[model samples]
Target chain A: MRDRIIEIIGTHGKNQGALIPVLKAVQRMNPRQYIPQEASQLVARIMGLRESEVYEVVSFYGEFSETPRAEHVIKICDSTVCRVNHHRELVDILEHTLGIRVGEASRDGKFFLEYSPCFGACDVAPALRIDDKVYGNLDRDKLEAILEAYRR
Target chain B: MKKNVALITENFHHYIPPDLAGYKHFGGFTALKKALALSEEDLIERIEDSGLRGRGGAAYPTGKKMRQSKAYQDDIKYLICNADEGEPGTFKDRDLLEQDPFGVLEGMVITAYAVGATHGILYLREEYAHLLELLQGAMAAMRREGLLGQGILGTALDFDMTIFSGAGAYICGEGTSLIESMEGRPGRPRNKPPYTKAQGLYLKPTLVSNVETFSAITAIVKHPQGVFTGYGTQKSPGTKLISLCGNVNNPGTYEVPFGLTLEEIITELGHGVAGDKGIKFVQVGGISGPLLPRACLKMPLTYEDFDAEGLSIGSGAVLVVDEDTDILDFLDAVAAFFKHESCGKCTPCREGNRQLMNILKRMREGTALPSDPENIQRIAHTMKYASFCGLGKTAPTALLSAIKYCPEEIFMRRGQ
Candidate 1:
């Protein structure tokens, strides 16, 4: 992981401007999907940025997680369009199925549910992103099918 | 009889094959080739004459912005296509990028030439990481064709572009904050005075424009025969692409002339509200935009008309709410979005939005006091005037506009 962090930092030139990309690359270095303390320290050393400064970038953006996450992440759209299109209903259904709230991960470490503000997929309202793939115009059956596939 | 001018969205209905040849076959890059022949000053002047404003809500004149960067004598100036289309309800840019990547690229290359910029960046939102592979492949094709590399199209003008994905920060849509994020920092707005055109990116002169605005430039430059100005009103000429969403029947990207009324946009373009629901109010812009009551339905969509009514054509996001929708619930969602996206940089935005969110939550739970609306208005006033940037300044727009238009609807008694 340490050597990989160095290589990622090198891939993006070792400069103050390269800090965000380096942190993003390092976070994707593991299934945990977080910038570990050691990785933050390594990024700080390579980019000549303060360790706290590195942590600031990670915490500021909602995408950068600080800890281990579930295997498959499900981000339900919570923006105005989706909300009016009954996103809350979807949230309720997901909670009922996964036995977790909007911000919680299932006990089995299989899925994480979150309220994402506008993924720019407003054309297809009531959208949700399972990992990186966005499924729009979602109904209960479609949501179940998607989760079922992910679960398998 | 005005028609939906298909300059930016002409080939939208068809699947755009992700290559330069595919784009060229659909009348793409033709404007760029013509633009390359014109001198930089002439190119800037032509766009200035067209009255094309920044499509990223502010509506600042595009040519004037490019001219500011052109005035600066920097050897390594930058051009950025602001594809960080995170504004809720504004999916027009995303559609433009997906449907016509070459049109946007052509706009960027031409804008870079006019502004004397050698390098460019497309600051795309992280959620649209799916489009990165297509954009990367398109750029490679452009490079091979010598259109993106040194001496593009056999001219001394040299320009190239790269993509930088923003990691979920709505505040990054603001120009300076976008630049700060590109520098690998937390996307926070900087105090203005040294505007980005003079000192931006790596403290170099830069030309940053919205994706739709760049796409518009391609259309504007392509038609030297005044076809661009033929559509829309005099003050606000050209077709404005609207991301028509919410309870509307045809909820999709629709390009309409600027002077079309809210009624026409909703009824004609959007095919009316879904399920035949009675229209209540419309949020013309994104979350930060003012809420227009049904009384203003006849109002024109021009910037002049919207500005006259103390509103903006912010990213052209038209969200129509039906009569069945609850105003308080909508406001609660809006408040939550602002609170969540607040960068917490300033006291007015951070503390003010938190207070606003708590009040809305209390109201939703039927535990609010009668004086809370007044309190929300007070906080909104401070955030509008005293807050740091556009996000803070415009955060209270919907709440205040709702109060102004439908006071009885929003500030209701508990359990009525």
Candidate 2:
């Protein structure tokens, strides 16, 4: 996680094309890790691009993170129509099985969760993401099984 | 656990009428039936007293706009329902327009009567064509039953609604931009102060409300003088509809009270993270919202929650950035999008976003000076100060917020 962040910081100083590649390289390391603050300015000087360009790229998308996250973060899709699709049931099952509520980390620090407005997966109706994996049509049983992976 | 909040699904599994017969069976328009009994001015007063705000991204007071438009000079006032779901992480309005069309229609018609608008328009996003069609069919159904167009249920309120779809432009979601688009102009935003109440759409007085905001008014119509005993906190009441997605066992839409904490929302509503890999951080309230560390999840999901986190409660967007995920590239993608979308209306936003992207690129490619952090901060601050519209002003929010949270990773030296 740390190495990738460093590598990306190196790329932000290159030409314009290097911006995305550097970022992608860092993302490959770990979405949860903090990106070094100097990466943007370095990128601008190297690529002959403006610092604002780097800022825009970093801020516009939902995937980037600038800090370290908890051991587990849960995001539930709660779009207006998703409410009708039983997103509540998913939240309820996960919350109950884990014995914790949304946005709350488990007592043992095994889990953390919250509601997400959208993940761009509407066809599945009710779907989920475990780390980077997407799981659809999940119930309490599936949810529990999924959580078991992190028990290690 | 919080005494159970109602998650009224506008576009979930099913909440609308298959036919007029079905609508009446389900209590559709009962609010209108009750609201039609009062004078338009009286209806406005009730809404004002209710202290309701628009559900769109702006969160402006609904009744205040209605009251102001009441005195505009022209009789040709317009009531535009902004069903344009342009925001990337937001799809709430489409849910209401597609599933619970009547709920939104009842509210819009009543609003039309109150604001003295003869014409109503639903400015929808092109991506939601299927939803738009569903709404059109509902409108035709409403007209067939005499519920719309010149008097209904023996009342004398005359209003007509039409759907005008917008081409792809996220900026159009802005109220003034929507007005400009509706009037056959470029979808760029105008300066505030004159506001939509004083001059909107065809240069006449106009009142614009989002799809969900208008639908809530239907609930208001039913209650009229009735009051909601207890619900959300003082500033924001009633249940809020949210689309939850990303890194959870259950990723979909649900409703909860206003002050729900991020922790409670995910654990209770979203279940736990899908995989045990662990959650490192969260981006609540979408792109314009703040990027939060796991530490802040315990706070309530209200305006206060955002303020405490140094973030904004934007458009009800809540996203999760799971463990072992890359923060730089994700930021890179966001930067690229802004570079493409910046209207270039102002030099600061136009040039600032571009320069930031360049700097980010150089950093990613290992080509910038050691002082990249200071440069990034200087430009980000400039964009915040000089951008003309919310699009520009808030564009750097996520990046800056993330930087504040994780300056080490963002500023890490490669050779070290």
Candidate 3:
């Protein structure tokens, strides 16, 4: 873990502005999809910054999560465009399919559902992003198919 | 019966992205070639004459920003393409970046040359992280063909660009906050006066522009001397990429001239509301922009017209809400967005958005408080005036505009 973290830091360098990218890479590397305490401390030590500074950035942005998450994070769009398109129905379907609420990870830890601001997918309203990819114009069946693929 | 003009989006549906050969075939880097031949002063002057404004919500004069960045005497200057399209209904920037990646890159290189910027950063929002591979592939092709890095087209100029991902902060869309986030800090807006032009992105002269603005710059440079100015009104020259969405038949990005009415945009371009539903109101720009009722649909989609009506063509997003949608529901979403996105840097925004959300929630829940509507206005006004940055200042625009356009909807519930 130390060697991989060191390798990530080596690529980004120990520059002042390299912290955000480094932390993001570290979070992506973790299987649980979070920046664990040890990883944050390691990043702080290698980047020549205090632990609070690292944690401050982690807590500030919506992308980073300190606690462990499911294998995939699903961010639903609850903004105006999506709301007008009845995103709540999609949210209900997501909860029913995953058997978890909006802010909870599935029982098997396959998916975590949370609300997100508009991610520029308004053209395809009622959009949700899974990890890096966005799925929009979603109906219940399409969403279930997507989750099924991720479940496997 | 005017048709949608296709300047920046001309090559959108024509070819698949990351295809360098196809992009060049569509006359991609001809602007860079044209811009390189002209002197820096000439390039800046042409931009000034073109009358292009920032496509991001601010609508600041793009030429003036470039000239200001150029005026600063600095060894290292940065040009950041603000692709943080977090504005609720604004997705035109994403479309431009995805469809015409080369055009945006060409514009950045030209602007870097004009402003004497040493390095450039494409500050892409993390939401669009899927586009990183395509953009990187396009950049790699440019580098292979001698279009990026060191000398470009065998000239004395040297400029290179890299992508910087934003970590889900809406306030970072502001120039200073963006710089702060890039410098590995919390994405919070900094105090101005030492503006980005004087000191930005590691405290050097920087030029931050929207993604669509850069695409427009490429078009302006490619066809100089009134050719680009032939479109749009006298005050607002050139077309705007309108992200038409929400309860509409065609919810997509359309590039249209400035003087067209919102009615035409909603009816002709958007094919009216979804299912032929009657229109209730339209929110031009993003969530921060004003909410215009159906009566105001006759108003032209120009900066001057919007400004005359005490509104702006913010982010060029036209959110058409049908009569089926409730005003309180819309306002609740708007309030909730600001509350969630407030960086908590200042009291007015951090607390004001909270109070606004609370009041709206109560209003939605039928909790009786006659003072809630007035209190909502009071808090919104405070946030508008006393908040630290543009986020806090413009945060209450939808709430305030809701009161102005649909007072009965807000006050009726409260029995006021």
* Tens digits of per-residue lDDT for model 1, B126-173: 888888888898888889988898998888988888999789899999
lDDT tens readout by residue for model 3, A32-127: 789999999999998899999988999999899988888899999999999999999999999998899988999898888889989989999989
B84-122 in candidate 3: lDDT tens per residue?
Answer: 988989999899988898889999999999999999899
TM-score of predicted model 2? 0.72
Tens-digit lDDT string for candidate 1 (A1-152): 87898799889988878877777788777675677778888889878889888989989997888877777778889888898898888898899999988777899998878778899888888898887788988889988898898888
Docking class of 2: incorrect
List all candidate RMSDs to the true structure.
1.5, 15.5, 1.3
The better-scoring model by DockQ among 2 and 3 is 3
Q: Can you tell me the CAPRI class of model 1?
A: high
| Interface RMSD, model 3, angstroms | 0.7
Tell me which of candidates 1 and 2 scores higher on DockQ: 1
The residue pairs that clash in candidate 1, if any, are none
User: TM-scores, in order shown?
Assistant: 0.97, 0.72, 0.98
Q: Best candidate, lDDT-wise?
A: 3
Please give the ranking of all candidate structures by TM-score, highest first, separated by commas. 3, 1, 2
Using lDDT as the yardstick, the better of models 1 and 3 is 3
Candidate 3 chain B has its poorest 10 consecutive residues by lDDT at B407-416
